[model samples]
Target chain A: MPEQLADTVDPANWTCPAPLRDQPVVVMGHGGGGALSAELMEQVFAPAYGNAVLTGLADSAVLELGSARLAFSTDSYVVRPLFFPGGSLGDLAVNGTVNDLAMSGATPAYLSAAFILEEGVELTVVDRIARAMGAAAEAAGVTVATGDTKVVETGHGDGVYVTTAGVGLVPDGVDIRPQRARPGDAVIVSGPIGLHGVAIMSVREGLEFGVEVSSDTAPLADLVAAVLAVTPDVHVLRDPTRGGLAASLNEIARASGTGVRLRERAIPVPDAVANACGFLGLDPLYVANEGRLVAFVPPAAAEEILAAMRAHPQGGGAALIGECVAEHPGMVVVSTGLGGTRVVDLPLGEQLPRIC
Target chain B: MPEQLADTVDPANWTCPAPLRDQPVVVMGHGGGGALSAELMEQVFAPAYGNAVLTGLADSAVLELGSARLAFSTDSYVVRPLFFPGGSLGDLAVNGTVNDLAMSGATPAYLSAAFILEEGVELTVVDRIARAMGAAAEAAGVTVATGDTKVVETGHGDGVYVTTAGVGLVPDGVDIRPQRARPGDAVIVSGPIGLHGVAIMSVREGLEFGVEVSSDTAPLADLVAAVLAVTPDVHVLRDPTRGGLAASLNEIARASGTGVRLRERAIPVPDAVANACGFLGLDPLYVANEGRLVAFVPPAAAEEILAAMRAHPQGGGAALIGECVAEHPGMVVVSTGLGGTRVVDLPLGEQLPRIC
Candidate 1:
């Protein structure tokens, strides 16, 4: 389903509403660990890319290919409603770390979680968080090996902030990095995008859309493992979380030092999500997807990988949307069904703050 | 400088804090990641005491130690003022992990840092944090091989939070754990305590204490190496952080299933810290420390370890404060200079919120 590169650049360019230079300060919704934060990462920060280590959004990334035995990665999760939709801060903490390790093509084994709770917060919440963390650890097949907790006075902090550091073992010969993308590489998405952000946003705004949109906040270790098994040559693997598809594609292009051409017709968009985006005048491409991923692979083996992804419960909505190209190095261009081309730029400013 | 145990314990007359039974809810300061969080951990969590892995507060704890590898522990740090006196969140994130590895009689070789950033935060702040992290890694002689960044919207987060995980190599014939304490073991402290907590509090409360109280946060890998070189039989090693000396001792007692006795007069307390505590109704014993450690060694080799600790820059103020005891298992008793005795209990609640 990967589309061919467009012959010419389209004149209809979609300018981001808020340019990076316009905002001078951070807002409350930005720290919600949801959509707004992802936009910031997608727009301003990710363009300056080089290392393959930074491309994989794992809690802790695994490095060292030869005889060296080690994996490392770091992650910070700022989820508002510290106690939220289906989980607490602790559950997110443990899962965040474990998922990071998994994203690195490693079998997540251990984790370290740090908690920053505001003053006067209830101890019951701490206990609940701890319990959630224990449960999350069990679910992810990892251990909460070490952790630290600090308390800040109220006003200086939100309810609770958790940072989880994870480490895992990467089997030999598995080399997945962003810079590995090559021309003719097929692009595949694990599942739907922007679910987590939309879910959190819906709750926060108290706006009930006819259709349900829950946070796609589940761990992706199993899905990653299955994809790796089917085709280890999967060149680039990235989770389209923050900054959604636009940010992720731009990052992949920059990392691989190549251009990406996505087809509007091939990309799958849920009807409800599409309708919601239309109503809100929001671009689904810029939304966040916690549990989904975008993978680039050899064109011949793309179908195998796609089939493997689809077999996983989390990858039920898997689809091929684009292909890597040699033109316009470090750029992502998309062909609209209306015979128009638009450069899918990195997200700019806050979009649906606190969507996570 | 290791000190002898001051025999002063009357188990029959011991008192315990009233059991906490209350409604479950999260308080703002609980997310501060300071003293209050520690209280919750000790009172409600640590008592679970299910395994050795849960008791030791080391980073990326060594799991299956055989002839090939030895030592295992885990720890988490939630220090507020992510960027604070003498160090920023990055320094704490890296060194905290390295120190945990060192505490296990291991030479820290690798570390991983994870960040949870609130949305709307300045990319400049993140870049600074990353730069600080790189510098910290250089200072600790380690590498930040992998990382993950998750953005939460505003109102649910502070500026940033970090978690670190590390692994180290334990030398031959080294065994360090809390339960290893013996009746005649000597207790030695690396340096002055309460600086980190007090410094954070001073800045947080906007108190202009006459003297500058900067956090004494630094990497302890070198100091730990020096101490281990002298005697691998180091019975126990601990960082007197949140809940400070009191919490560390109680942890050791519970871990080793033994008792500890200390002389309050023999313990080292800087005049400024003591004064600040006096003014704030706080106890230095329960305050936090970033660049301080307590080591328990065999009485025979206590002097050697003390000398080694003193030789290091971080241990300039090293001193012997107490010793392990056979009676009153799982208890820590302190003899005041005034000839009175009191059981040093785990801190009951948050003291000096956000004092990293």
Candidate 2:
């Protein structure tokens, strides 16, 4: 019977998709969550896992199970040096998926933690990561409901790679997805950007700014709840993690077939993070942010939502960074500080790989 | 802040749980799903992720969601060589979690796949695996709802490691858990055992029996559904993947506080698998099996369920293997082929590691 199953898949006769034809082997960029990442999905994963829910390409796939609307999402953390400036892989493992569910306006509820460990990993190290995850889950008001652990030979793996899958209840009447972004919607960010990517790069490159930049690895569930309280008609919500703000905006624009127009001065970038990115020749817009979200909402309710975001502790620095435009579908245009407009594109690959 | 969250978990003052105290570092046996696996869970995972639902230690944690009972489980496939005689990692990835959800008496619904791939792996190889997963999911009647891909440096990972988390819906009036096993319950196995473990070992050890051996890596969800039609009061069900039939019986006995009495001659082991195990000095009872199940049901309904199982293509070799007893609680007793009896204890560690 196994052979019968094998007969269905003729790998030898399968044709390579055009975008992926040149790249015969997977590169680090394919996992970078940028243009290459999109190519991989369109060429490889979409054909394999094409479904109404998954093709939506949201952070979480919202499904109706019985009478409940559930949001499910998954992420794997391969961050180097388990511990970072302010957060560890444990925090990323929990908060990353929690934030993904939050983007769907779901009440983050349960998580499954699966770890792939290399042989010879100290139990104490894993213990620390687990406890950190426990604390994060507690902070986010979720439970780690199931877990699995697999150990590979010492040479087959790095220290530890954690994969976390989350299930949250998407409240009724809340339909937040990247594809819902529309022209004339306001673009807002919850807080400052680039700190997380800078913090990780600082550690990896052994470079120090005048002031240290720590990861903004906080759970955004509460902040998202606050936003939902203001309005259920929110169009899109995205957590810019891997490919950063640029990739998030470009993806939203592409998904919604709209253009994005941003004011350069309106975007918040902390001095330390700005200096770090400048020194590293990295764009703050393309640098990742762990505890931040970009929202697309009706222009009418934008100010009220911005006020609500500003009142919350995690979103105190929230601002209206841009607006969706009717021109140049699937493009992002930023007005420079000098009054010149330039196009912004998703990075070919993330400069800082495995930051999250 | 991240620091405030860190303040709660004082890693410096945290004490290592006693069961894990001696093993300061992870070993291959910890992932073996036997004694070491149990110890790691009880000591490490339980303390870190202890919740009412997870402490049950069922294959899939059953959660009560709005108007429905949901079952969720996670397993990561790190089986070496990617492909073997009968199955690939893709088949195992899809079937493994589906079987886990099936053990909970649930209709497997959705799966999330997270891949950890090493850089420089061929795209065609990944394509083959993805297509295989697609075919398997289609055959199993589940969707790959969401997915994530991460790339580690070449030396930091094997070719590809896939972690699959599944969600299923437990039907009304169908309750199944290992602890539900009762003293009068009868034990039945769906089909032949030890084929999967032997198949992998044969390839790894470069040994062959006179006849070819192939892995029995098929989804058991449908077979489980067929058995459920016979009776809804199934006491316990397990796939016996990593630690095999002996471990499954032993765990059931321990969980239910009952003794398991098996007739050695009734258990099915294919000739090639038995021959291969004998040549390798391996115990067939400790070998892995996919696409199979060991069920504990009321003795009155055992014959009907066995007939139902035998009629199904996947369960053609089904047989009544054993029964549960009150005497020698928490132990497994087997009557030998020579008319002697012996206690079958959970192995200190599984003989075959990563066989799943």
Best by DockQ: 2
User: Which runs of model 2 end up more than 4 angstroms from their true locations?
Assistant: A1-21, B1-21
Residue-by-residue lDDT tens digits, candidate 1, A11-41: 1232323543366546543433333444444
Task: Kindly state the fnat score of candidate 1.
Answer: 0.47
For model 1 the local lDDT of residue B2 reads: 8
lDDT of 2 at B251: 80
Q: lDDT, candidate 2, residue B115? A: 88
Q: How close to the true structure is residue A22 of candidate 1, measured as C-alpha lDDT?
A: 64
Interface RMSD after interface superposition, model 2: 1.0
Per-residue error at B351 for model 2, in Å?
A: 2.0
lDDT of 1 by residue, B10-124 (tens): 3323232223234354443333323334445556445422234654543336654222352323333445666776887767767766777777778776665555666677767
Instruction: Please provide TM-scores computed only on chain A for all of the candidate models, following their numbering.
Output: 0.83, 0.94
- Residue A28 of model 1, lDDT score: 48
Q: What local lDDT score does residue A97 receive in model 1, on the 0 to 100 scale? A: 57
